[model samples]
Target: MIFAYNKAHVGDVLMILVKNDNGADVTSTRCGNVTKIALKETNEVVAWNIFQASEMLGEISGVGQVVLSDEQIALLNEELAKEGFREVITQEKNSKFVIGFVKELTPHPDSDHLNIAQVEVDNGEMLQIVAGAPNIEQGQLVVVAKVGAMMPNGLVIWDGELRGVKSSGMMCSPRELQLENAPDVRGILVLEEGSATIGEAFSPEKHWHG
Candidate 1:
C-alpha cells in the first residue's frame, strides 16, 4: 500500500478508489492487464492492480506487498522518497528473499574476480556467500536469494560453491528480480543507500509489468 502525496497535482482532498466506477472520472492508464489509479485532478497515481501478464506502457511505477517492521512509515512522506518510489516487499510469511548487509569481503583463492563475502541476512546469522559481481562490496545493503527461491527467470536458488568456496545464498540483480529500468550489466543489485532494514523481506509483486 502507498501513502504518497499527489505528485501530479497539488490537492488538499483525498480520493479513495476501490473499484473501476470509483475512478470513472479520472483517466486510467493501461499497465499490463491492470488499470492505474490516476487522479482526476492531475496525473497523480499511487497504485495499480495487476490482472494479467502483458508488457506495460509509459513510466508507471509498480507496487508489491510489503510489511514495515518499524514506524519509519514517515520516510514515505519525504519529498525525495517519492521519485521512483519502490519497496522491498515480502509476498508471504516464508519469503524467499531478504535484505542483507555485506559484512566482509575477501578475495577468492582460486578465482581472479570472485570474492568470498560474509553477509548478514539477519541480526544473528552471517551467511558465507561467494559472489562474482565486481560491484559487490562491504557495508552495502542488498537483496539475498535464499535456497529454494524461484527467480523470475525460473531459476531456483540452491546452496552451491564458486571455485570451491561454499556459498549459502546469492546476491540478486534487478534484472533477475524483473524490476523496471534494471541495468543491463553484470553486477549485483544494490538497494538505495539507507533504504533497507536488516532482515526485511524483498519479494516484490511478480505480476508487475511496469
Candidate 2:
C-alpha cells in the first residue's frame, strides 16, 4: 500500500492504498465509507471518503490523495516492511540506476554478437549481465540498471535469461537512461575515466541543480 495526497482536497489530507487481496478491497474495513471503484475486469475497491470521482488503474497497488513528508514516507516504509510487504516510496528523490565497471567480458556460446559481462556495481557485488552492443569492453565504466530499477521509459529491471545466459540486470545506453543531450549513437554509454565511482547513482539532474 502507498500513500498520496488527494489533489481535490483543499486542505491537507492523506490517502492510503490497500491492495486488492482475493479480488476484494482489503482495506475497506478501515475506511468506513466504502467507495467501490471498478478496476476494469477485476473486483477491487478503492474505499475512501471525499475523494474526487476518477478512474481506477488495475496495475497500481494503490495511491492515496494524501501528501506525505519525507519522514512520514520513511516511517510508512518501515511499518510496512514489518508486514512483509515491499517498501513503497511515493516520491522519486534518488536515482535507482548506478555507474558500474565492466570487470570481465566473454563471448556468448550460442550468439556471436552477444557478450556476457561481469559488472561490479556498488555494494561490492558483481552482477552477471548479457550485453549485445559491440562497443562494450572489459574495464569500461558504464551505467547499470540494478535489479528493481525503473527506467525513465517505464521499463522495470528484473532477473531474466537472454538466449541461454542468466542475466541479473541491464547495461544501459544513453537513450535508455533518458539523458538530456544524449548522443545519437549506438552501443552503451561509456563514462570518462574518473568521471564517477563504480557504484555512484546516475543523477543527470544534479548538473542542473544549484
Q: Residue 191 deviation, candidate 1, in Å?
A: 1.7
Tell me the tens digit of each residue's lDDT in model 1 across 32-117: 34445656776565344333111211222322222333222233223113433342212233566888899999999998989999
C-alpha lDDT (0 to 100) for residue 21 of candidate 1: 32
Question: Which residue runs of candidate 1 sit more than 4 Å off their true CA positions?
Answer: 1-92, 203-210
Instruction: Put down candidate 2 lDDT per residue, 56-136, tens digits, no spaces.
Output: 211222233223456655654554455444424355444547889999999999998999999999877899999999899
Error of 1 at 156 (Å): 0.8
Q: Which residue pairs in candidate 1 have backbone atoms (N, alpha carbon, C) closer than 3 angstroms, thus clashing?
A: 89-203
> After aligning candidate 2 to the native by TM-score, how far in Å is the CA of 157 from where it should be?
0.5
lDDT of 2: 0.63
RMSD to native for every prediction? 16.0, 8.8
Q: What is model 1's C-alpha RMSD?
A: 16.0
